[model samples]
Target: MSRILAIDYGTKRTGIAVTDELQIIASGLTTVNTKDLLQFLKDYIKNESVELFLVGEPKQMDNSASESEVHILPFITTLEKVFPKIPIQRVDERFTSKMAFQTMIDSGLKKNQRKNKALIDEISATLILQSYLYSK
Candidate 1:
């Protein structure tokens, strides 16, 4: 079976996560520069069968689209043009960053390790993927 991929898109960096071929267990894949994300996905798809793309949809406390959506919407448009075969879905991403930080604290990561924005992004992506899996 093909795996599901999730993305936590940020202005400067993007977090990636994927489920196993059996569609069980979401795991952090990596953090990549936003500019390189398309190429990275192209390369990844060459090696893995991706069934769908789950993108984090940033929203404010009031459930309005967050400012980041301005950037994400364009990226989603391009992603559709590039990978028309794969379906894309949006998962609510409110408080993901804060949750990621708390997860790091619970994991007992040191202050320096917790300060790694890339790691937090990666974890956030994993959380998004896990949430999607649970929803299904």
Candidate 2:
């Protein structure tokens, strides 16, 4: 099995996660600026055996698509254009950020560490990937 890449897409920053080749474990990769994401993915794909792309789908509490859907939909279109062979999937990311912060708190991270937005993003991506894996 090849690695599975998961993305927690945001307007400003996008968090990335990857599963092992066996697809048994999900781990945080890095957070990249939205402006640089396409080029970053291009570079990443050249070196990694990525089998799938999982994107976070923001949804409201009522199970409706969030306002960000307008932006995310276009991003997904671009992603498909760029990586046409790789399959893309969406997983609800209703409160991953909140869960990431709570995870940091539970993990005994210091306030300073908890305030690191990149760290939070990575954790959010990890949660997104885990959620996708669990759903499967």
Candidate 3:
């Protein structure tokens, strides 16, 4: 079966995650520059079969679109255009970053490692993927 991919998009960086072939577990894949995301996905899809793309949707406390949506919306459009064959979906990402930080702390990561924004992003992506899997 094709795996499901997840993305945690940020202004300068983007985090990626993917499910196992059996779609039972989600794991962090990598963090990439926002500018290089499209090319990165293109290269990834060439080697692996992805059945779906789950993008994190940042929403405000009132459930309205968050400020980050301005940037994410455009990226989503571009992603659709670039990979029309893969179905795309959004998962609420209200506190994935905070959760990622907490996860790092719980995992006993050193302060320096916890401070790595790329690692945080990757964890956030994994959280997003896990959320999607649970919803299904």
Please provide TM-scores, in order, for all candidate models, with all chains considered together.
0.99, 0.96, 0.98
Could you tally the backbone clashes for each prediction? Answer: 0, 0, 0
**Model 2 local distance difference test score:** 0.93
What are the lDDT figures for the candidates, one per model?
0.98, 0.93, 0.96
lDDT of each residue in 69-130, candidate 3, tens digit only: 99999999998998899899999999999999999999999999999999999999999999
Tens-digit lDDT track of model 1 for 12-125:
999999999999999999999999999999999999999999999999889999999999999999999999999999999998999999999999999999999999999999
TM-score of 1: 0.99
Error of 1 at 51 (Å): 0.4
Candidate 2 lDDT by residue in tens digits, 13-93: 999999988998999999999999999999998988998999999999999999999988999999999999999999888
Q: List candidate 1 stretches off by more than 4 Å.
A: none
lDDT of 1: 0.98
> Lowest lDDT 10-mer window, candidate 3?
78-87
Distance from true position, residue 92, model 1, in Å? Answer: 0.1
